[model samples]
Target: MRSYGNKLFLFYIILTGSVLAVLGFVLGQLFPFYIVNYFSENNIDLDTDQIDYIKKQFAFIITFLLVVSFILICLINGKLIRNLLDPIENITQTARELTKGNYRSRAFAVGPANIVELRNSVNLLARNLQEIEKIREIENERLKTLIENMGSALIMIDREATVSIVNRQFLDGFQLDLDEVKDKNFLTLGLPKRIEEFIDHVFLTELPYRKQIEIEVNQEIQYKQIYGAPVVGEHGRWLGVVIVMHDISELIRLEQIRKDFVANVSHELRTPITSIKGFSETLLDGAFKDEKMLISFLDIIHQESNRLQMLIEDLLELSRLEQHGFSVKIMPTSLQEVLIRAVELTSPRLDEKNMQFNVDIARDVTVAGDFNRLIQIFTNLITNAITYSPENTTITLRIKKNDEYGIVEVEDEGMGIDKSEIARVFERFYRVDKARSRNSGGTGLGLAIVKHIIEAHYGKIQVNSTVGKGTCMIVYIPLRKKRN
Candidate 1:
């Protein structure tokens, strides 16, 4: 490459040559005239040979000086040019490094004032660019993290309706691989028909769309709340769409439970209320005239009233246990003591049935729980066992403690629960055998209450049963250190 030094040297030589030519011309004219006049006045004459000799000497001296001056100028010009060009060269190198993604590269401050200024400006620009790049990287990472952990499925598409980005939630929830769907058109991606239609509408309208959609996945219906919006570019240009999918299946199920609870409560209240009203009416309509009939009717009314009271009390207790502010009175309580109290409360029924009791308990095992609530947990389980087991059947009660938990188990050799019905056993007012449960004086809320009590103490309850074999209920409550 032609350098600045060389170009400057060439220009200097040309200008110096022109100046020497003009000086030579002036000297030739003036010196000749002046010398001739002086020689004439002084009566001095010179031969042509001597004149030629003098002229040759003058030409040789001037040529030698010109060559030396040219050499000096070349040296000066090179240094000057280098001083000017070095900063520019460094700046260029820094630019190259920046283009290569090395933002840390910088130019040294050197050369003239102007060159230094230029270098500073270039460095400032690079610093600003670096800052911008850092900001962009941080924002990108934050966006990625939010999308992955949002617990909602999301997809992004390009203007061509090609799937360009899908987050981890979307991939896992839908069981898809990025390689299978990325860069492929939406219609060919095997998405649900409803989702495809949603995308199409959002793309066409370039507006936000929201809807609730149901799709069967693996033969199970899933409810989703989907939101679709157009991705707009600069100047409001259409840039495909983004779809956000939220699984609202749990919300839907809860709403159905609420409705069912209302219906079931109404049905339960109606039966008892009907009985109480009918029996009271019979008594008032002259059944009181006959002593035997009056006594029988009064007894019927009193029994119905008692059942209603029991149902109401159970419902109230359940409501209290389920309240959001339901906090148990937690303290160090003995598991053995709680079990003894529950057994004492259920002893009358045990004796009447002549059911054999098998107790295996470890003494002084302590757990953190509400004392009264723990008693209620075991009492409900024992009473449930008593009602289900036949006379003379053996009922087992076991208590033990591990490093983490105090475990209590109550098992009965009664007709075991159906496997399919086991999952719903703890539901409020849920009865596996409705007629038998009512006849045996069950409010159908007993197990539900027991579940809440155990959970309040951060414990777990599990049931194992076979159709012909007996049902076994096992409970675990977090163990605590013995009180001092």
Candidate 2:
């Protein structure tokens, strides 16, 4: 720019100097002719020396005036040219800054009207660019926040099949960090094989795909509902693929439970109904004529009817306990009293099995719960212990306080449950020994009802057992704290 300005200045000086020299030469030549005419017209005789001296003076005066005019013109033109170039120079610098992403830079609107207008246009462009950048930044922040907080795990892959964006849920779900996952190839990130295959399929087809896939994490099976789609931009440009995963393990488990419940209920009901029908039909077919046979058939029918009634009642109780917003009556109740009442209620069963209760009350712990529900919970536990244990085995009942909870444990020397079956014990109609439970007249919803009641009290239940050794049912209930 400086070089250009110098060249322009030089050009202006040369042009001005050339014009002054030409004018001076033409006036000097014309002055000689005009002076000679004037002298003749005045009737004055002039000598050659006088003519030569006057011509010398005239030539000197023209030379001095030309030099001064040249200097004056150069000075004025230099200022004028500088004024013209400075605004353009500023606009040029501003444009350079804009290209470098400095939207705040602006040119000065000085100099001639045309130059000023150009500078104004550049400034307006810069202002618009700055506003657009601000808007873009805000939108970017909003998108970032939404992705980070979304409930489902999300991953975005670029056209190169590289992980480009991973949200917090994705990182946490996969037990990964951003540095470990981002910029890595989608298949090489140690994702579940099923998930990787799904993503790969989407990328290859450039189409939307969805599936419920089973995956194992930390040795536990999980069910995920995954959705993948190819990202297409303007002009149908394939950008990449985006994958979203929703953890549906609970939903899948519930669905399985529902199916099992339906099958189990149908079977359980059919068994007792068939028994009642068969025994009654036998009696109707002249078996009632023999008093002994009639009594025997009637007894069998009565037992099955009782069993069926128990099953229906247990099912109703479980349904009620499992309902939403179901609450237990919470009041200060003595744990010792509840356990004693449960033991008394189940004493006839214990006696029938020839089992003895080894009661150990560490303290009369008080907990906030329904007294009747507490009795029900312990009665069911004790009854189960008797039903599963051999005769002459001692069932140990203990009540103790720990921290904020009153713990009641019903430990029995019984046919202990296998570790794999322990988790399903509380499931509706789940039984370790189905035939034994049916013969013992258990409805099989005892543990399920106990679990719901415990949860309603904001408490917990834990089972510990080793096959062929013993099983312990530990119930933890929050203690009723005394007010100061």
Candidate 3:
């Protein structure tokens, strides 16, 4: 039951006692006899007074020797105990530091061989712990960076339905900050109720879930695909659920456009096809006997057939333009020549509408594009201006060059487009006045084709219009250097 300190003190006391006892026993047996023998051997005769003085001197000598021996033992034991305990004290301090998470601490390898070995082992353990801690920290940082930059919105909720983690993508996508979401409830973040329901279901069932969801943000409908999975810990313990969302708004929009295109094409073809079939059947049913009626019906049939052909050609051209492999033949060509050719082609409409052409083109201005596509672009613009403008109104074709591009503007004092519909003018099958466009022999794909052609040349086209004032279509094409 004695502590180490008490045991050490007791050992020191016992060793001192044993040394004194042994010295006392030897001195008791031999000291007096040696003194008598020395005096007898030397033949030195003494009186009673001389013997008494000698005995007193012997007692004094034994006492002084015992005192010196005790002092030496005490000094030596103190030095030995200090040497034994100092290294052990250093090792204990290091252990305490390690327990406090200071893995860099190390004990000094001093003292006896065995103690030195223990110190070295402790130091080795500390170094290993430090290395392991460093690696773990690096891995944790890498995981954090990966989650933040994963490009898909991600949210994690614990079993308590508390939002635990939201990455950078989730914050940016939802227009939220860390303070708004961290440690918040899953149902209270202004998220669609369906998302909250899905999270609750995941937590209750401890299973994965996936669905396509529609959400409205800023009054615009958006489609998203969500993937949810349960996060489980050791021994299948439910930890949390992780949800990832991918935006599919563009895909949904494209699908809608495709459906609309199919329906419009069908309707456009059906009208012409019905007219041609009816006229042909009538001609075979003795309507040919009346020459005047026969000629009128045949002409109508021919016009309808031509309109159908034009619609099909426009659709095919648009499909080609949108194909992945579609490419333009880019070569330096004269912008002036292209404009002149387009003007000549549209002169028939100009003559019919009695419109005046005001042409102003820069001399020798060149552009990089396919010649036929450039001609098509200008032809469509001029024809549209002629079709929409009142007779005798001037249509202006001004071509010029700036620092980096050749610019062309086809302007008209026509019944202009509305501001709200201006943005959608280049969309296929979009017409400002559908009935008027049909009667004027106009295909609604003209501006759409013009846009595709301009985009192929890496150029831009824009429209500016004020109702009842005028409309101006501006095209900017990259200028090409003249070859010597």
Candidate 4:
């Protein structure tokens, strides 16, 4: 561009100089002829010396004027050339900056109309590019935030099969760090075999794949719904593969529980219904004529009906407790009073089992809970103890308090549960001794109900048991704070 400007300036200078030299030659030629014509018209004669001197003076003047005019015109043309090219040069520089990702640069709009317009266009382009860059940055930030906070674990692999991106959930779920996973080959990240296989399948096939996979972590089984697909860019270019894992362990367990619950309910209901139907039919088929048989059958039917009623009521209670937003009425209640009432209610069962309560009241703790619900919790616990313990066994009831909670423990000298089964005692319809519990008129929902009630009171329950020694049920309820 600079060379082009210099050429243009040189052309102007040459054109101006050529025009001045031609005019000077024409005037000098005509000057001699005109002077000779005037002398001839006036009847005057000129000497050779005078003509030669005048011609010499005219030649010198013409030469001087032409030289001065050419110099002045060259200087003016130089300034004009710079004015023409400066804005263009600025626009070019701005374009270079734009290519280098410097969108903030702008050309100066100072030149002729066309050059200034060009500069303005470049500036406008820079503004648009800057705006687009800003929008892109904002969108990228939004995408990053969404990925980081999303519920499911996400991992992105590049075309080279290297781990390019991983979300927080992915890192935490896999117990991994960014430094360990990033830039590492997907196959070499020590991921679970199942997950790695799935990722490999997607990468090889370059297609979408989905499956429910089981992975063991920390000695526990976890269920994940895995979804993987090949990521494609514009023009259908294959970029990489993305894998998303959603933890569904809880959902799977709940589904299994649902199936078990349906089966259990049907079996439980059928037993008593069959007993009542069989006994009633027997009585109707002439057994009622025998007074002894009739009374015996009637007793059996009455017992079956009672058992059915208890089962139904327990099922309903558990359903309500497991419902969403189920709340218990909370108040400052005397834990000792609640325990006493529960003991009184279960005293009949205690007598039937020939069980004695060893009441150990360390402190009458005040707890924040629903009074009736608290009584119900203890009542069920005591009833379970009495049902499970042998005759003449002592059930110990202890009331104690810690810094933050009121602790109640129901310890019984019963056939203790196995360690493996201890964790499942709170499940509905789960019983350690199914025959004994059913024969003792247990609905099998007592512990489940007790668990829900305690949880509603913002408390926790723990069980400690040995196979032959005894079982201890501990309940921890938050203590009520005193007001000044």
Candidate 5:
């Protein structure tokens, strides 16, 4: 027996059935008596005395039917009570779960049918919670991955300069341990004096500062620029500061490279362009008077034009190769044919350097690639060796075949690349000997072009060099494309 609803239901059933039963009884009494009295008074010899027994029997039947009707009403009242109470009980349970921060919990339908509004409200809340959690997870993962992989070191500190978070990359890059440094005062830690003072300044002012700090790592001094900003929380609360330490070693190197490239390009172009302009100007000024002078000027002009054209062509080729989605058709081509073309192109340079050429292209070393690009690649490498090597030095072009691939190599006993600069030799406009590179009439782009063209063919190019001894360039190329 539930308290309020059950008691109200019992009272309603009893009261409603009692009133209806009384009304039915009244009607049965008055109507039956009237009918019987009318019959008795109007009829003659109609057996009125026996009719009284009939009226009594009729009254008894009406009383029995009224009692049965009251019983049906009580049953219906009980059903209504149960239906109302069941829904209330379900809602109460759902509220209790919600209070426990079970945001995903939902209410169920109860009683005769589900209440649409209650179920919809609960469902809406759960859906909102699900969507919010999903978004939070995605955002958290994205940020975590970003921090873990970013090249710069990242650290977070409170306004009091207490470290809060230090990414693993930052920790390893700086040789720090979080367990050892956590909850420690930066000013008293083994940090450099300048950095400690900077931290103290930031904490006192609750502002940010960017400064250059130098640290020794692995016995080498490294330079970095550290930038900080105040981290604000809800209601303008000053939570902490976020610090980003950016390594500027590469940046500094690139800056120097840019300055050097400008000077080199200007100096190189000035001499040739000046020669071409001077010779043309002299010829225009009636220097054609001497047919010999005219011929000499024309020869110099042709050489200058060719040099300019070669440099421009190399620049354009590099630009084209760097573009994304660039593809080459890998077709079967004879290695001998490629070598012959490269030799034909470099015959002038080889003759100028007085170098001997020996080619041993395997008859069976047929490679699959863009034939024209491969020719350009080898032509550049051979020309470079011819330009760098001394007179009468033997340059070798060896081509061979394996079970899976073809190989081509250019070896020379030249003023070889330094071991340190060997790795960067293929970079754009890089020259191991800047002075010697200029004197040799190099545009400093030949090897870079070779590198890109080989890579585009899905081949690899490597260089082995010793500063005073010699150098070898190796190219590995696939014989055929594997089926995907």
Candidate 6:
């Protein structure tokens, strides 16, 4: 009871003061009465009735005076309490504001030493909160910037699945219309069932999730890897969920390309080598006994050997292009010479196909690059045109020069590349028509090698094709090396 009520400082002060004031009033009333009685005994003789009346009247007056003095004491006590309580009222108001998140609130310094100590403590607390708020603001900006530059898209939606926050990458990755997404529900806005299921699972289980889904959004199919984590607030309350979406299509494509390249490389080198091995073994056992037949087998073996040699040479050349210190010679050279040589190298191919070649060389069309590498670039393009085109379709090479660069384009009347396959044309072992590519003995390294060579000369290549209309491959090379 003492600690809860009596030991309370304000109550203790007010109570102690009231006790002292009452005692003083009682003594003051008694002392005067006692002095008046002493004077009456010494100075006057009174009859019994008169003496009784005087005593009664003195008792009444003392009683009335005591009442008046008590009232006065109470008034003074109240004024003193007001002096003690006014600082507390100010501190309470500030504390109320602090509880409302106004950490900058401060208390008045009018109270006693101990109460002043409390005020200082509160001020220090406010200062700390102000510092924390400043740090939080800076961190928020830094975090937002970090999220903007991150490759993955991040979005946070409340429990109702309304998007409350979306990082910059999230907006750009999906080409999202921000205004449309702000308050829309995933169900109403048309999200995939898999994504909805994932969100439901997260909410129900109160756990995180990760899954990859193939999304066909707006007629474009893409592989999206989604990871969702719970946003927990105070007391482990589930506030929202954060989703990070990553575009894994390129990585997936590269992995597939790597696997195919290994398989294709094995098939390409093994076929002719296997043929030579089989024929040589047969001849060694008994086929050589028939001499006339033996000569035909030897000729076939030589042809296979030459094919193996060619394959090995091309592989070595590609390796050289990839190695460090194997840079191109950037000097202005006649693109005509490079195109002519590329055509001459493919002459046997044209003759074998019995296909006519159309050459349109714009006068003074020039490029700056290594001559041999540039020749390889054009030759690969021309050879692909010849190999892929139908029997009677003509292959055309056109060169035109502008002020800055020369453009060499090869147009072939062939079964054009599928729109989906065009992006991966330069990737090794990517074939638009796999069956035709394999049957025609396309090594698949040709375009890959051409890509490296053209890039080495700081050139660009673009392909445009329609299904029935043949493909056009444009090569852009600088007329002079633009010095940096």
Question: What tens digits encode model 5's per-residue C-alpha lDDT throughout 219-253?
Answer: 45567888777889999999887778888866866
Alpha carbon deviation, residue 434, candidate 1 (Å): 2.3
Q: After superposition, how far is residue 416 of candidate 2 from its true place, in Å?
A: 3.9
Task: Kindly report which residue pairs in candidate 1 clash with one another.
Answer: none
Candidate 5 has an lDDT of 0.78
Off by over 4 Å in 4: 1-137, 159-162, 171-191, 217-221, 234-238, 286-295, 322-326, 347-364, 385-424, 458-484
For model 2, residues 57-78, the per-residue Cα lDDT tens digits are 9999999999998999999999
Model 2, total clashes: 0
* Candidate 4 backbone collisions, by pair: none
TM-score of candidate 1 versus the correct structure, residues matched by position: 0.66
Cα lDDT tens digits for candidate 6, 367-448? 7888888888888898888888888779988999777779999999988888777878988767787777756656667888
Number of backbone clashes in candidate 6: 0
Model 1, span 1-484: residue lDDT tens: 1375577767877887787777766765566567667777999897778666766666676667767876787677767777777778888889889999888888995977888898999899889889988999999999989988889999999998899878988887777888977898878877778888888899888889999999876555789999999888899887789999999988987787688778878888888889889988887887788999888888877887888899899999998998998989999898889988998999999999999789987567888999999999999999999888888998899988788899998999998899777877898788887888888888888998999989999999999998777999999999986658
By TM-score, the candidates rank as: 2, 1, 6, 4, 3, 5
Worst 10 residues of 4 by lDDT: 213-222
The all-Cα superposition gives candidate 4 an RMSD in Å to the true structure of: 8.8
Cα lDDT for residue 140, candidate 5: 91
Full-model lDDT for every candidate: 0.85, 0.92, 0.87, 0.91, 0.78, 0.80
lDDT of 3 by residue, 236-351 (tens): 99889999999888887778767877877787889899999999999999999999999999999999999999998998998899899788999998888999899999999899
* Winning model by TM-score: 2
- Write down the TM-score for model 3: 0.59
Q: Please, what are the lDDT tens digits per residue for candidate 4 over residues 1-484?
A: 7888988988898899889989999989998889888988999889999889888998899899889988988898899889878878888989999999999998974977898889888999999999999999999999999999899999999999999999999999878899999999988877889998899899889989999999987656789999999999999999999999999999987898789889999999999999999999998999999999999999999999999999999999998998999999989999899998998999998988777999999679999999999999999998888888889999999998899999999999999998768867988889999999999999889999999999999999999998777899999999998889
As a whole number from 0 to 100, the lDDT of residue 421 in candidate 3 is 79
Candidate with better TM-score, 1 vs 5: 1
Report per-prediction Cα RMSD to one decimal: 7.5, 7.8, 8.3, 8.8, 12.6, 10.3
Clash counts for the predictions, in order? 0, 0, 0, 0, 0, 0
Question: CA shift at 314, candidate 3, in angstroms?
Answer: 1.9
Query: What's each prediction's TM-score?
Result: 0.66, 0.67, 0.59, 0.64, 0.52, 0.66
